[model samples]
Target chain A: MTLTINDFADLRSAEALEAALRAIGAERYHSNHPFHHLLHSGQLDKGQVQAWALNRWYYQSRIPMKDAAFMSRVVDPDLRREWSQRVVDHDGTREGVGGVTKWLRLCTGLGLDEAYVRSEQGILPATKFAVEAYVHYVRERSLLQAVASSLTELFSPTIIKDRVAGMLKHYDFVDEATLGYFQARITQAPRDSDFALAFVKQHARNEEERQQVCEALLFKCDVLWAQLDALHHAYVLEGGIPPGAFEPVREQGRVAA
Target chain B: MTLTINDFADLRSAEALEAALRAIGAERYHSNHPFHHLLHSGQLDKGQVQAWALNRWYYQSRIPMKDAAFMSRVVDPDLRREWSQRVVDHDGTREGVGGVTKWLRLCTGLGLDEAYVRSEQGILPATKFAVEAYVHYVRERSLLQAVASSLTELFSPTIIKDRVAGMLKHYDFVDEATLGYFQARITQAPRDSDFALAFVKQHARNEEERQQVCEALLFKCDVLWAQLDALHHAYVLEGGIPPGAFEPVREQGRVAA
Candidate 1:
């Protein structure tokens, strides 16, 4: 459903505005993409799965930079303090402990080497484009849009659950340790999304501002959907390996076909 | 093909520097993507073609804005005077004439309404993300990289040649008039890319700056490739349409058994 800001122009309560934005996600999020269907069902081949993880690391790595850009712009100390945790959440205290470390572990479990993955020398051009776009969005657009894009965290928990459950049940090679990232994320995503959603709702004052918030969430969804699309196109359909993406193995029984 | 530039080193000559930058485009440009093969070959369905034109319009439309941004930063009168014509080339003196208008005409030829195409309300999130990334890359990155990204136009004339030739040969519906955009682009791109290349070569004096120019071109390749990935995903492979991308009409024979 296409929503015009006018629909919520007269809204006085935050609850109604929140409901409308949530409904946008309920209907439009990446969880609804068929590629996700393949992912959650374990219908994707190992290469496809690897592509997902490798491409995702780009997204994972950029969070802190983009969030820092956002935090740097915030004048309010209390809000900056609250938002700073997001940077810590992704970067972690030491080496292999935080969200980025977990994401790297996920890539490692997929058989990607630490140095190569860190180099980002193996990711698809499309993945880089989409991920960088997210970083740029956070940096350039209004603070409200930055916060709103983070609202995709609103729908991510459900996806994480489905992904964890499906991979565990359908793929024998997958195990809890390899999936440590989601364990943290299952809790972390909600906390992050909740903070973001509340921030957006509270801060987005006029109808125009509210619409920008919605558009930001939609843009985040596209950032994600575009990633999957690149993976599917390069690995699943034409099988055209872009110049730098992960190389799919030559297993005969591979299911991506 | 990876370049390492850790310190500031001066260049030997503009010719050698221009060669290095062009080499970057040769290796990284998105004309090499498989999706472009389908696009120019007319292998894509009507919807896929429509999605391409529509998504690309976002990039085309932004040419002037990016040029304007670059112009805003330039301190030299001669440089700004030469650069400002890019804005005129894109936005034009009056409506229905400039590069943007010609692009919209191409979109109209592909079956999109002028208002719908112009609203850009329906462009894939990835397209907006990539294009916005380009604009911001110009805004924030080293001025050298900003100039370097436009170096894709260095390779664009070849892509334009192949695209026009292939489209004319493969599609019954496409004609030269509808592709006036490319015809103009043929001359304009070479001239533009040439100027940008010379500017970068002369300005980017050291190895570190040279490497940034190369990486900038790679970043730009990602931008173009990502746009195609979004279109391929939304309109072709996954068959899932985002809320507002082009809606494909299913042909009777095109349905899978």
Candidate 2:
């Protein structure tokens, strides 16, 4: 049951490679993580959900920056045109817009202060590390791998659908307006992922290049999954949150206003 | 109790501020983390230990780069003279003689391939993130806080004592020969941390600057702790190691020679 890059080369076509990559997503995506289960099932208390939103806002905010960084490295103007839309999508034309602005609304809906979330004063260190890892991955790796890694967008729609539905059904606080980010992503992610997939598939000519593409997707999956793991460890299992990260509800009032 | 930077402004002397900083170290440093306990107690298997060595090598390797970056920022000749030694200490006069070279030997001592370790081919994404965070930290933060963050070295000797003794006692494979890095650190860390502490206590004048210093040290602690957390999750708890990182002992023989 062990998978390696060597197994990727035998993939005869992009279809086969795409299927294997989706298989990896099904098996290992953050949706399968326990924290997501808690999130959807409404098992997490308000504070936990707040922590999730606040920590996740950091990730959401950085996406466009990373995408821009990735876009900056691409040589082709045509390709750059496709990738630039992502930055526009995440950072909308006006204030109180874009994915990041939407994510901040989710934090506000969860009862977190906008300033605290923006300050990143209350998010977990693990969240920062995980998110920054993705940024660094895109910046340092080959442009092909950078584009390929964003292929996690390939799987985001299903999770978003489940998440929006589950949050509506399970959590009282997260209403349609607060969860609007998912609505945009349902379309935006597929559009983005499709372009990226075709780009990677066409460009990766050799076995080594193909393997790098596959591995890039896998690396990104780890980045996302690792974010959840840190949340689970710090906020769930040990109940030992790092200093200056999100404070639990019972302890929130104690930290200075 | 939560600590604040304003309290330091009213301090009686530089020694008081230094004590407060050390006190922050006593409370918040990585020594309190469970992974450190697991590492020092030898509860980790050889593969877990190998993962530690492999990931930590990334941290070790970057110290010179960070030192160089830090040195590049210092304008004072006196400070530059003192800071430049750190880069020399890490890089050494010759290629195979410095801290990085010593760390490579530690990796090889733990059964890693020399070329693979030196190439940094298999390091965990989280490890790279943590180290990159450090380099970026030194690059972006106020010079005073950046110096204070290195104050973790002030606490390093004690952890080094525990790590060296416990690693040697419990792991039949470890020896003074393999862990010679810590022996050098025993003397060097104190000398380094002392200078850093002196620098921070003298330079951090205002409440905001003082708070920045405190936060920087905490940030550095998180950097160190997150590295261990990532290694633990990937190699031990979650059980999915990243591609190109250390293979478990069972798989090592199967990897290409």
When summed lDDT is taken over every stretch of 10 residues in candidate 1 chain B, the lowest stretch is B248-257
Give the per-residue lDDT digits (tens) of candidate 1, residues A1-257. 54433354544556766887887788668898777889889898777887788888998898889889998888999989999888888888887689899889988787766776787767887677788888877877888888898898888888998999999998776788889989988888888888988887889887677777877877787788777777777777764665545676732122223
Give the distance in Å from residue A182's predicted Cα in candidate 1 to where it truly belongs. Answer: 1.7
Q: What is the lDDT of candidate 2?
A: 0.79
Task: List runs of model 2 lying over 4 Å from the truth.
Answer: A5-28, A41-43, A70-81, A137-143, A203-212, A254-257, B2-16, B73-81, B94-96, B111-122, B234-249, B253-257
TM-score of chain B of each: 0.89, 0.91
Model 2 DockQ reads 0.33
* lDDT for each residue of candidate 2 in B1-257, tens digit (9 for 90 to 100): 64433344544456666677787787778887778899999899887887788888889888888988887898988988898888877787887877777888887888877776776656777677778888988987778977987989988889999999999999998888899888888888888988988788888776566667777887898888877777766776653565445677745565436
Alpha carbon lDDT of each predicted model: 0.78, 0.79
lDDT of 2 by residue, A1-257 (tens): 54555566666677776777887777656777778888888798788888788778889989999988887888899888888899999889887688888888888887777776787766777778878878878988999899888988888888898889988999888899989889999999889888988888888877677788888887887788778767776677653666556767744565435
Give lDDT: candidate 2, residue B151. 88
Per-candidate TM-score against the hidden true structure: 0.87, 0.86
